[model samples]
Target chain A: GGIITQTPKFLIGQEGQKLTLKCQQNFNHDTMYWYRQDSGKGLRLIYYSITENDLQKGDLSEGYDASREKKSSFSLTVTSAQKNEMAVFLCASSIPFSNERLFFGHGTKLSVL
Target chain B: GDSVTQTEGLVTLTKGLPVMLNCTYQTTYSPFLFWYVQHLNEAPKLLLKSSTDNKRTEHQGFYATLHKSSSSFHLQKSSVQLSDSALYFCALRNMLSGSFNKLTFGAGTRLAVCP
Candidate 1:
């Protein structure tokens, strides 16, 4: 059973500041994804990578950037934090082409001040 | 546009009672439905998935069947336990709109089991 680890479980950033969240998976899955979850709302996709060094934007990728530096790691960056913004960013990994199952990280809670 | 809808915001039940969570979806492709469970401060875990219509899929005492005709995949358990109290999310997979490995999720249902 492989695990997905996300670092800096909680983050606080000032308005207009740039923040980055990191994720690592040991599942050796070929696809990785980043999603944002707001209170009382559904999870929204931000970005995804099918393979190393590949990046694809999702429906909510306007102010976010993603990178798959290696097969085991995926990272997301918030271009500019907004005041009073609070959400949880989740990282997930899955197999190639098949939507079989996604192993998810515990999520990073972000609070912008 | 692909989307999932879980109408119940919260469900409270006594231990040993039956459990049911409603999940509905809207998608253009053949639906690939899934149920995910999330404990407090923990990552969401996959509970069950079904792409075949009218067939029930079971896991860890929970079961759900994807009904394409009605666009619904509701989760159910014969009996509820305190351990089953958690957040449940219904999801649908979509790859048609130039998106790769993307999942559309429901708002989520919080199940609280009281002993």
Candidate 2:
């Protein structure tokens, strides 16, 4: 079985600062996704990529940017951190088919000061 | 607009008790329902999923039936154990969407099982 690895288990950033989170998967999956998890809000999609160099916005992509520079890696960037903004960002990968389940990384917890 | 709703925010129960978590959804297209479970500090994993209407699908002692008419896919288990305690999320896939990767998730329900 393959694993999905997300770097920086925790992050602390100042207001208006830019922060980046990284994800790498060894499943060789064709699709990758970024999701934001907030308390009481479950998980909201931020962006997804079908393959290398492809990006698609999701329901909650307003302040985030994603890049898929390689088939095994996907990255997300927070444009400007907001004070008191604390959330967990998750990275997931899946096969090309719709019926396949996603494999997710542990997550990166972000705290903005 | 498509959305999934999980009504229970928190559920506390003793071991060996029955457990049920409610999930409902709204979508304009054909739906594929899924249940995911997340242990503390761990990533959420797929617990079960169903696409056939009115048919029950199960995995790892958890079961859910997709009801097309009611837009509900409730997760249930007859007996609960301490290991069953985790955050549960309901998700929907819009089969009619252009991209197959689009998955809309509901607010999760947290379950605590104690001895």
Candidate number achieving the greatest DockQ relative to the actual structure = 2
**Tens digit per residue, CA lDDT, model 2, A47-106:** 999999999999999999889999999999999999999999999999875789999999
Give candidate 2 regions above 4 Å deviation. none
Collision pairs in model 2: none
Every candidate's DockQ is: 0.77, 0.84
Instruction: Report, to 2 decimal places, the DockQ of model 1.
Output: 0.77
True contacts kept of each: 0.78, 0.78
Candidate 1 lDDT score at position A73? 97
Candidate 2 lDDT over B74-95, as tens digits, reads: 9999999999989999999988
- What's the TM for model 2? 0.98
* Chain B TM, cand. 1: 0.95
Task: Single out the weakest 10-residue window by summed lDDT for candidate 2 chain B.
Answer: B94-103
Scored by TM-score, the top model is: 2
The list of candidate 1 runs beyond 4 A from truth reads B95-100
